[model samples]
Target chain A: MRCRAAVAALWMLTVPALGQHQHHHMAPPVSDSLQWRMPPMDMSMPMMPGLEDALPPTQPLLPSMTTPPQARPGEVIPLADGDTLHLTAGPVTRTINGQSLTMYGYNGQYPGPMLEVQQGSTVIVQFHNHLEEPTTVHWHGLRLDSRFDGIAGISQAPVAQGEAFTYELYFPDDGLYWYHPHLREDMQQDLGLYGNIRVHPGGEPEAAPVHLEQLLILDDVLLDKHGLIPWGEEVPTHALMGRFGNVMLTNGVTDFAIDVRPGTAVRFFITNVANARSFNVTFGNLPVKVIASDISRFERQAFAESVPIAPAERYIVDVLFPETGTVAITNSIQAIDHFRGEFYPHVDTLAFVHVQGAEAVPDHRAAFGQARENATVTNDIDAYRSHFDRPPDKELELSVRVQQLPLAIMLSMEIDTLYVPPVEWNDAMPMMNWLSTGAQVTWVLRELSSGLENMDIQWSFTQGDVVKVRLFNNPRSFHPMHHPVHFHGQRFLVLEIDGVRSSNLVWKDTATVPVGSTVDFLVDMSNPGSWMAHCHISEHLQSGMMLGFTVEAQNQPR
Target chain B: MITLLPFLLGGLMMPPTPGVCVWTPEYYQIALLPTRRVPEARQAEGAAHVSFVESPFGIAVTRAGHYRYKLELRVSGLREIEGHSYVAWLATPDLKDYQRLGPMPANNVLSTEVYWNKFIVFITLETAAAPEDASWQGPVVMRGMSRSGLMHTMAGHGPYQQEPCTVYGYY
Candidate 1:
């Protein structure tokens, strides 16, 4: 009887299962997804979990309560300072790469709508939730009023089905921001419920205006043969690694091509809205100058070959086409196969540029070629330069804990070892990755001092305090992966990564911390109100990897 | 407006007052060496030479292979070649065992850090966009040494700065 108890205890605890995996370095099967084998379906849970009906379902399209609606682009509602706009959350179907899939959209549009507002203006947004579940529109990367910041419990209650709530969004920074549901983003956001907000410089004449500009929302979806892959009914699927889609999308379509005049300098404002993937991409090897980021432009303009963007982060790059031809905008990265211990280059063309015409209007190649130095951003970060060496104010560990996972996952992960690479490139173990749902996995943002995980960690700061927080992603955890840590209602600077301080300091709301890495960010607690910080990966956010903190006046209660 | 900086190839900002440059744990200036590939007319144009700061990131660990300082490299006056790039490398003074810092990004700047006290910094022009091998298979175009590794780049500040940190022209 005692021996039986010991075996059962060992089965439940993953720490004891740390045995040696056979392959030290895995060489993946080349050129074929068919060669990759699947797992046994009789494990424990089905694609659709806890459904009352015991009827065996068809091959791919599982049971779903939401139906697909006719899809379209959310009408852009350009508002002046203090203007109001109406927004709605609903279900819609988007066809990607010739395949139609069901998704939860805003205002019947896949990427809701592009809300254009003037910088330094406060706009009132009346948000109505039409989805069956609760939702909230988080004005991501914005330092708006705390009441309108949009995390359900902190800013306001979750707007339930058929309910409406109002948000007074203030755009203080002149850059590209975004809006998306703050509740169950793993499903709501992954399906669609998102949009972009472009805040133009408030009434200021352009320093260096461009002939043309474009906003590109980069996204992806997981699809199968029958229809859209089913989402977990009880908890979020792909809980361990987050959902990596087979289909990639740009501005809600696979075929995202735009026309430009030869020798034209077009400014491209790119935002990554994917659930987990970090795209290391380039624009047809064009003469690309990185101009701005999430909140502010760089102090100095730079030319680079690729743009590596993490989820929820924004980058503004201007590309110059010296001659006319077809230019393919693509995301290419050397992805590692954890199971195989080999690297594979994954390249997907995000969009295309048909530059095959004479300059219709006067192009800005000459003006764009001129060097740009934004002294404002450079001078702004100088104040924090004195505090870089200060001891960290807080240390948070980004890690995952698991319970009730099947024996196969436990054993496989044990062999895979506790130490994994800094990044997970693909859905290497699809069946096991998805099966480790929220019921069995819990990603945490634990405060090291108090040993508090997630919301239990309460941090308070003065309105003007530059709080330095060190985030260490534990490499020893099972299924270790990258986490894009994002803070709400404030702008922070990435001070350092793995102990090296930042040389080029730009204001950012989100930053990616690779596995086995240590990152320290100094949050400019200028906004006084309740705020939250969490990993921006949609599935990780839904898996309880979040915490809420309050920012009071410098003289407020200690 | 976008234009080339006033030619100051040999040194930036009056040579940072040799041996008297600002040296706090927070911010520091790097003494960049002139590269032969860059013509005398280009100045500090073709390679990285600029700010090094200890931003809000924490103190460097004392353990081996732990970084204690960072350098933000800004390169200008260069053009891009298809599938080719300027790869950054940090190596020991003996020219053995290098850490291949990946290719410079679209911004023409390499955001980098150093865990070693004495090392050689070189930027090689590689045929590929990103090279995965440990050994660089390209020709070195620009080079600088961190003999005054951490703070001695100020020319005469610490024990590291017994040697001159800056050499104006390649000749």
Candidate 2:
């Protein structure tokens, strides 16, 4: 009996370690051996009374009240004009103590509308642009036709003011995606123009019942004393770092609270819609499990102390409520200089998970099956490293500069010639009169090495030849460079940083390159297509920091 | 008029004046009408009645009935001024205040070859206290100017030197 008890204790200790290794998909037997070294103890209960042996096996409590919204198999939903969706964009307006302001919206909400569709289903949406200017909707992270890519002037024409465009989107995968404007995107998105999308997996429903599921669209918004700040208004100087909103909101509510029963597992689909902010999100005390990222589900559930979500990113995390109390999920980066003055810790409460009920639900850790058998290598790591060892196929460098010129006197002289003198001129003009400096500053991206007006590259490669890209942020400039480097249609491995490899490296479509830092990544051009590699920062891209290279079909084209 | 003379004299009295060149101001006369006219009538009648006035500085446009238009002035017959540019903006009727607009993208000197007929400036004038026109129109005109030296450009791009030029119109 003592030996049996020892074996049971050893099993408990090794479970968590095994779980981590399986989630990351380290090597096979090596990870198994590493897991056996740890022992698991019942951390939930410190001590068990003598009557523990007599206790019956705990059963999961009667299924919680909430359940995921049902999606019929092969279901297709069509969103026509005049269908209203109720949503709020920023934190609870009442707590904000500012004038009620309106932002870009569809069905009278900032995020337009949420369009939920089943995988392998076609969704017909009649999109409309009511803003004064032209804008187009880009279904971000969605695999769609290049013509429907929604990049104004690139993939299609902008939806003119008061214009409507129809979309026939057929989602190929089941995951979390989002939608936002692609014209003057930095300002429009900041003014609250985004929404969440969920494509449910298609197939027979699994037997395991989901108790509670919710969609949490997370965003930070800058608000003025009156309310939502006006578009085109001059922002503060520190905005170069990033713009931190005066208010933070989840699902348009500041202090949104959710109720959950003890031990009830809930799935949350979280999307960060902030313009440039990255969220370090955490639940105050409840432990959470991440199940999926932007594109696909992970091989196994992974637990994280906090999840880091950059702009236009999404994650799905499952959490089991522990006790009957308020659990706060908030942005964990409080003191970090997130561009604004000082990071006000817990400035916004994403959502509150309130647990209720006495009986504890049986843990489903054993029944929760793995989503994928193995974490398949999406990118070739060794080939990626070797590509980094050699020189890049091509190098492109860009710079950002700021200077002032005399504008007021020139304007006055023109006015005089026009025969109408301005009402107020010639008194000592304030220093802030310059356009773009205090009120508006224009940033330019100029190619330094090649005088090529257009950034179009043509290259030929074999099926699996790894292409290396080396991006350097020159230090001679004054402003710091924070670029979200993005590649189209493929994922790449960040092989080296400066010159070293990191085991914790993860595959990503976009990665941030810090100021004065050089980052190198390699992509196996297995997919033959003209792909675009550009800075994901919408403002920087608008300022012309973009380039496109073609992965030609081998032996087919010049 | 006396206040305007002293301001003009003060501008001319700069110790190291950078080769001053003068041009005649063009003028136009406009008539204010109580009712909105047809597009053709508004264009043909307004243009026919407009007059041009030539001043020592440049050309000024004048017209009847709250007319609004733009004037382009070009400075010619001067060597390229190094590191200096002409700054201009609209001023109040008393010429004591300036409204910032934007800078003219040209070199410091006004040459007919550079800024065809000097710089193009916009002006609007309205007789009614509240004009219903969708465009800019207000009575009372004044213009402002200053000659920026090369040294001024050397110091950190001349703080706020790019403030847009403003234009005023009086009926």
Candidate 3:
């Protein structure tokens, strides 16, 4: 215990220093000049630069002066024909890199369709199951009636092949949400039964100076020589890792290009729909002002050097193209080349910003002032900090590890039909099972009973006792799992990572836990109810890498 | 280019081992039998059908006809991606087919077993004849699908294709 304490103290000393070094290296220098002048001409615009010379310099596809259509409340817009969405689900022929192949799609599109609605409005969607087998649609992250959540057997009956189901969903809050299948999620979601849903707040006039608002749904797919790979055909063993695709796509298109005029302030609502992969996205070297998150608008605007979005997460970033010739929104995280276990050199160009037409307004400096002030302040860090700092009665240490076995031995075990290997990794093993399950390998969450039948634990705490939890990722094992740890109903203050504390930690519901690293956070369990804590990776939770604790009033439910 | 080497090589380095028949009934037969019971020596004789196909990836076993059954081409010594690594029910109109179920509820059988970066393929049929028991009819086959510009690199090498097979039962 003394040695452990000593080690902890040493970590406390070293981590902060390392964090200081990283902060210095990563954080951009703040320009003290509050003049808000247009960036120098030669400074190279951040989002899309020098795209004017790349194109044939042709006339812009859409007029630059065109304004985006505004949406208002009490609008009963018909999203689909009745409650049933007549969607065509089948293989579509498409050519990628000069090779023609068939890929599965819904409504003849890779990403089904975009469903737009107003907050507090009722959404009645009639869906037709066109696939050969039965399936259902789940509105991810939407707080709706349990029956409309679309879980086969759990919430509602599965829409049989050639059958249809109508879902009546009421959007309680205004924000970004998504939809996909809840059953055979690994297969169906990967097979392209996914779409984006945006709910605009009711009774509010649209913010002015918002030239264009674009929905960017980021998805990663593993394509075969034919086109998009089909799911459910091959049954893999590893369920923890979920599925990883080779191709990264935005709005269902690869090598996509978006044309815009210089000095245009655009709203880019980015959503990560990948099954397992997390994206670190950058719009070339441009500055981005993040306005909102998954569920609601931020108290203040935050700047992102590079936005890291995990699955089922959303970030709305406002970026003004300084002098966009052409800028590339690229995936900054390097891909993992399977063979060498090393990083791969691939720059997936997600989108292109093509600036066309002569300068709309000379001296783009005026554009900043002309832009309406955001009702919310830009740099109110305290408001962001207040969202966290909740206290919890109980604290737990969660770890993720993988178990490795020889290929021949593992195959023999399955053929012999001897013993069923444990789904999750616990105290015994460390490697995750990506190959067998076609999901990431085994990950176990310990500090609980084995059977999990009677998981009733009482966590006692006062009204203001700051609950601190130290999360550790064992480095002594192979295939350290990156858990996007999340807490339900409330947010917390991220105190430290790898023992180093960060005062600049942003408020988030999900925080990525790197391999062989440790993160600490403080939470106030003021919300008296049973809350769940687990990795955001859906596969991990499906494979039993999850746990929950209940917070009660001092003399409440025993 | 420099970082992609390991991933490319990882795909290439995976060893291709052929499948082996771990359990084959001695006297299994695919024909209509006089009685359900059979002599010990010919345990598999009255069985509707029995056939196995071997490939570099693994072996596939299938039994069809009045009673339908399908077994995946699986490798034993391997572990599953998540949960227990065993033969699961892929797709069954009825939920109560498999003896023991996994984390997911019994009714939905989209996938049976998960293997090394690949999932096992199996399906059973539900008919009035075997209302309680899941059975299948006709020919049982296993196949692989690929898409264009998509590479299936194993152990860090090329997107190699696996040979598909159709298993038959001789009465």
Candidate with top lDDT is 1
- Count clashing residue pairs in model 3: 124
lDDT of 1 by residue, A351-468 (tens): 8988876774676777878767778888888898888999989988777888877655675565443224445645655656756677778998888788899988888887889998
Query: What's the candidate order when arranged by decreasing lDDT?
Result: 1, 3, 2
Candidate 3's residue-wise lDDT over B50-147, tens digit each? 22221100111111001112222221122122322222233322223323222222322222332211112232222224333333331222211110
In order, the TM-score of chain B in each prediction is 0.57, 0.24, 0.16
iRMSD, model 2, in Å: 31.9
Question: Candidate 1, B106: how far from true, in Å?
Answer: 35
Q: In candidate 3, residue B9 scores what lDDT?
A: 30
What are the per-model numbers of colliding residue pairs?
Answer: 11, 84, 124
Candidate 3 lDDT over residue span A1-558, tens digit each: 999988966764543222122211122224531111111121111111112112111111111112222211111224522333454444344444444444445665657677777777776777777666678887765655556767665457888878888887766556677777765556566655677778887754333345678888887665444333333233333354555666667776677677877777778888877767666667888766666666555544555455666676777777777784888887664333221122233456678888776554544445433434334322533544543444422334344333344443243222211111111111111111233342324455544323231123334445334577655544223334567666644345555554344533333455655443455666545444445566656566554455555555465331
- For model 3 the local lDDT of residue B111 reads 21
DockQ of candidate 2 against the true complex: 0.01
Q: How do the predictions measure up, each by TM-score? A: 0.70, 0.52, 0.53
Q: Residue A407 in model 2: shift from native, Å?
A: 16
Cα miss at A67, model 1 (Å)? 5.4
| Residue-level lDDT for A317 in candidate 1 | 84
- Candidates in order have lDDT scores of 0.68, 0.44, 0.45
